[model samples]
Target: MPDAKPAPAQALSAPQKALLKLGLTRDIDLALHLPLRYEDETRLVRLSDARDGQTVQVEGTVTHQEITLRPRRQLLVTLDDGSDTCTLRFFSFYPSHQKALAVGARVRVRGEVRGGFMGRTMMHPAFHAAGGELPDALTPVYPTSAQLPQAYLRKVVASGLARADLSETIPPELLGSLQRVVHGTWTLRDALRYLHHPGPDVSLDALEDRSHPAWQRLKAEELLAQQLSQLTAKRERDALRAPVLRTAPGGLHEQLLAVLPFALTGAQRRVGEEIARDLARPVPMHRLLQGDVGSGKTVVAALAAAIAIDS
Candidate 1:
C-alpha cells in the first residue's frame, strides 16, 4: 500500500507556509528536515584569531559605516570585537541595512574571512543586532526562504519532534546486528536528535567532517535505504515474464564461441550463462555490465548479441 500522507501542522502562519516551499507541512516533514550545515555557537571567536577562508562568528560593535564607489559601489563597515577590528563589506546593500549598521550598534556576524583593502574582511556576512543571549550548543543552519524567522522555525521543528510519532523503519534484530558491528547504540530517533540538538560535548571537528558516530549511523541508514530501493526495483523487473529466445545447442552459438581468440574466464562464463537465462525470458532483459578497463565485458556482450542473432 502507498504510504499515508502526513497531516499538516495546525494553524501555520502565512510566513511559515511560505518558508516550507518543499511541501514540508507535517510533523514528519519537520522531523526529516535535516540541517544543511551547523554553526558551532558554543563560543565566539575573537576577530584577531579568525583565519582567512575559514567560517567564523564574531560579536562586536559596528565602529564605522560608509558607502564607497572607487572600484565599484560598495558599503564598508568596521567591527571591533575588542581583540581586533574586521571589515564588513557589502557590494549590494539597502538604505535600511545602512541604517541598521549605525555606528556603535553591537552585532553578531558569521561568514568566511577574506583579506581586503582594509585588512581582515567578511563580505555579505550573515549579521544581526545583538540579542538577549547566544546559544551554548551547536546551532543548526536550516534551508530557509526570505522573511522567515529562524527562531520561529526552530520552535516549530522542536514542537514537531515533541509531538511526532516516529515509526521504526529497521527491524530490531537487524538493528542489533548492525549495532554490534559498528559498536553504536543510537536508534533512528536518537541519531536525528543528536544531529538536530547536539550537546556541548559533541566535537565541532567531527560534525564538520561528517565523521561523528551519529552521522555515520544516519549515513548507513541512507545507504541501506538506497540499496533496498534498487533491489526492490530489480525484483519487480525480474518478476515480469519475458519472451524466451533459446537457440539450438550446437548451431550458431557454438560457431561464435569457436571463433573467439581467447577462452572466457570463469567469472565471464558465469555471467554469460546468467545473461543467456535472462534473454530466454519473455520480459525485456534490462542489464548493465560494469567493470574496469581490462574486464571482458565487451567480449561477453558480443557473445550475448550473437546468441540473439542466432535465435
Candidate 2:
C-alpha cells in the first residue's frame, strides 16, 4: 500500500498545514520538523561559464523550439539572456509543457552543461518549467525524497501555503525590538510567506537579505527545546534518593591505582567520578562504557564487582 498519510484527526489549522506541506512532518514531532539546511539560490550565472558543462542555473530566452525530427525525442531549446547563449536539450519530457515553450519567451533554466557543439555550449539538462516569464527570485530547492513526485510535491506546498492566524512563538516585545534594531528586516511572517510562495515577486536578494530573522528564530527555538528537555530529564533523575554505598573511597581507589602499571590519566579521573556516582546509587549500574585495553579499566571493573559481592 502507498504510505497513506494518516487522515488528520481534525481539520488542520493553517500553520499546521504549512508544516505538513514542507514535509516537516505528518506527525507532531518538534525535533524532526527542523530544517536540515538553508539552500541559497541567489546568484544567476552567465552561459559562457556553462561551456564545459557546468551545473548552473541561469535566465535565458527561448530562441528556438524543434519538437520533431530529433532522434532521442528531446527538446532543442536555444537559450540566451542577452549576455550569452547555450542550447538546452531535455530528453523525453512530458509533452504537456511543449506549448509553454513558445519561441522568443524568457525562462529560467537550471541543469548541467554538456559538451560544446560548434564552439557553443550545450545544456542537456533537467529544469523546472517557468510559466508566463522567469520569476525574479531565489528559488528554494527543498530536500526531496525519491517517493514524492516533484510536480505533486510543488502542488502540495502551494495548497498548504494558505496562511492561517498563527502566533509568533517568540515574545512580541523582543521580536519588535529586534526588527527596530535592524532596519528593513523582513518580519517573521513575511519570510515564511515567501518561503512557501517563492514566485515572480520575491527576488533572490530578498531571500538572502541579512535582515531576514526566520532562520535565527527557528534555530534558537530548536536549541532551547533540546536544552530544556535534557535539563528536565536530569532534574527527574536527581530527585530519586540513592542508596549510599559503604566503601572506604580512597582506600579502595588508592590500592587499585597502585596495581596499575601506569599512572591514571585525566580522563580516567573524570570517568572515575561518573562511575563512582552511578555505583553509589541503589539502582543497578547500567553504564555503557567505552572501555579500552590497559586503561586501568580492569581496576575499575574489579572494584565494581567487589561492591556487588561485599553488599
Candidate 3:
C-alpha cells in the first residue's frame, strides 16, 4: 500500500495569534504565565455596603439607562440592589453594551466605587449577566495585550494547566533537600495551580511579597534549572578536545610576569598559576576569575593571554 499524506495544519484564531505573540505556543508556557495580581470576585457586596474608593463587585438590576450628551456623550446606567442605587458610567461604549445593559436586566458589575455629584458611581465598570455561582477562588488578572481579553486568556490558561505535563524534573532526594531549604512541601503542579487561582483565604501579602510556599517552590525550581543548565554546558565543553597550549620555559608568560610594573598579588598569582595549568591540558578551560573593583583580574587575564599567544 502507498504511504498516506499528512494532514494539513489548521489556521490559528485571533486569540491564538495573540497568544503566539506572547511566546505562549506551548501548554507549558501558558501554565507558567502566572497572574500579575488577583481580584476578589468570589463574593459579592451590597451596593449600600460598598464604600467610596473601594473596588467591589455588586449584583443589581438596571433600573434606568440613557445616552446623555451633557458630558460629551456618555452612557449612564442606574443599578439598584434594593438597598441603594449606583450609577454605572461609560464614556466610551458600543451598541452591544447598551443592549446587554438594558433596563430591568440583572447584571453584576465590578469596579472602584466613587462618590460624585451624581451620588455613588463606578466609571466604566465591567458588567456581565448576573445569577451565576461565584468562583471559589480569587479571579486572576494576568498580564495581557490589547488583542487578548481576560476571559479568553483565563479559559485557555485553565485548559493549558490541565493538559500540560507537570511531572517533576528533579529527583525526589533533591526535591527533599530543596523543600527543607525553602520550608515548602508544594510540588511543581500544586504550586502552579495554587499560584494561578489562589484561594480567598491565602494571604495576599505573602503572595505579593513572594513569601508564599508556592512562590518559594517556583524560585527553587528556577534556580535548580539554571544550575543544571550551567553544569550540562560545562560537561559538554569538558568532553571536547582542544590544542594543549602550554607555556614554554622562560617564554612570554614568564617574561610578562617577571617584567610587570606592579607586583602580582597573592590571589592574582594563585589564579594565574591555575590558568597556566588548565592551558597546558588538552581540554577547554571554563574558569571564572572574580574579584572586587580595583582588583588584579585584568593582570591575570593579560598573563593568560600571554600564555595563549606564546603557544
Candidate 4:
C-alpha cells in the first residue's frame, strides 16, 4: 500500500493570527487566558441617579449630534433619558459610531460619568443600539492587542472554553485533601466558567484580590503542576548514568579533613559524608549545600574538590 500524504495546513484569519501572537494556539491556552478585569454592564442606571466618577451604564435617546473642530475634531452626542441628559464625547470615531449615536437613536452607553459646566459627560464611552436583554453576569475585559476586538475575542474564548477538555488533573484523593484545607469545592470547569463571567452578585473585591474560591482552585492547580514538573525532572535525572567518582581510603579527601585547623561541626561532618557517598555512585549527583553565614561551607567544598582531584 502507498503511504498517505499529510493534510495541508489551513490559512489563519487575522484574529487567529493575533491569538497565535499571544501564545494562545491551543484550546486549553485560550481557555486559560482569563480576563484582566470585569465591567459591570448587567444593569442600566438612570442618568439622574448616575454619579460623577462612577462607572455606569445608561440608556437614552440621542437628542442631538455634531462634529466640532474648535479644540480638535470631535463628535459630540447629547443623550436624554426621561430623568436627565448627558453628553457623549468621542475624540476618535467612525461612521459606524455616528450611525449608532445618530439623533433619535436609542443607545446604551457605559463609561465614567463626569459632572462640570457641561453637565454630566462621558468621554469616549462604549455604546450600542439599546433594547437587548441585559447580561446576567459582569462583562469581562481581557488583555489583548490592537488586532483583536473584544467581541471577536469573547466569542473565540467562549468557543475554546466549550471545546477544551477541563477534566481534573489532580488525583481525586489529593484534590479532596486540598479542598478540605482551602474549604473550597469548585471543580476545574466550574472555576474557569465562573472566573470568565462571574455573577453580578459575586463579590468584586474577592475576585480582584484573588481570594475567591474559584481563584484558589486555579492557584492550587498551578502549584500542583509546578511540583509535578519538578518531580518528573528529578526522576529523569535519576535514570541517567555518570562516571563513578571515588577516592581511595585515607586518600586526599581524608588527608584534607585531618589537616584542617578548625574541626568540622557535627552537622558539617554529617553532610560531608553524605556527599562522599553520592560521589561513589554511578549516577550523577544533584545536591545543594545550604547554611547560614559563617557556617563552614568553604571547608566542605574544599573537601569535595580534593576527592574529585584524587579520583
Model 2, span 1-311: residue lDDT tens: 88988876878766556556555553223222222223324456787665564667777778888865546567777888777777766676666556656686777777766665454545455444454544455444545555554445454554444433334655766767655544535454554555554454443454455233454544454566799898997777777666666456556555666687766678776777677778777654556667778776765666665554444
Work out the TM-score per prediction.
Answer: 0.74, 0.56, 0.87, 0.84
Off by over 4 Å in 4: 1-10, 247-277, 289-306
Best by lDDT: 3
The lDDT values for all models are: 0.82, 0.58, 0.92, 0.91
* Model 2 stretches astray by more than 4 angstroms: 1-75, 79-85, 92-119, 122-137, 158-213, 240-244, 248-274, 281-302
By TM-score, the better pick of 1 and 2 is: 1
Model 1 per-residue lDDT tens digits across residues 1-311: 99999998699676776756766688878877777778766667998888879888899999998998989999999999999998888999999888888998999888888876769988899888876676866888777677566676777778887777776688987888776655588787887887888876787788768888778777878889899999999889878886678756786777888988889899899989999898887888998888899889988888788789888
In candidate 4, what are the lDDT values of residues 123-207, reduced to their tens digit?
A: 9999888998999999988899999999999998988999999999988888788787556788899999999989999888888
Q: Give the Cα RMSD of candidate 4.
A: 3.8
Clashes of each: 6, 2, 0, 0
lDDT of candidate 3 over 39-137, digit per residue (tens): 889989998888889999999999999999995999999999888999999999999999999999999999999998879999999989998799999
Query: Lowest summed lDDT over 10 consecutive residues: which window, candidate 3?
Result: 177-186
Cα lDDT over the full model 3: 0.92
Regions of candidate 3 where Cα sits further than 4 Å from its true position: 1-9, 69-72, 173-184
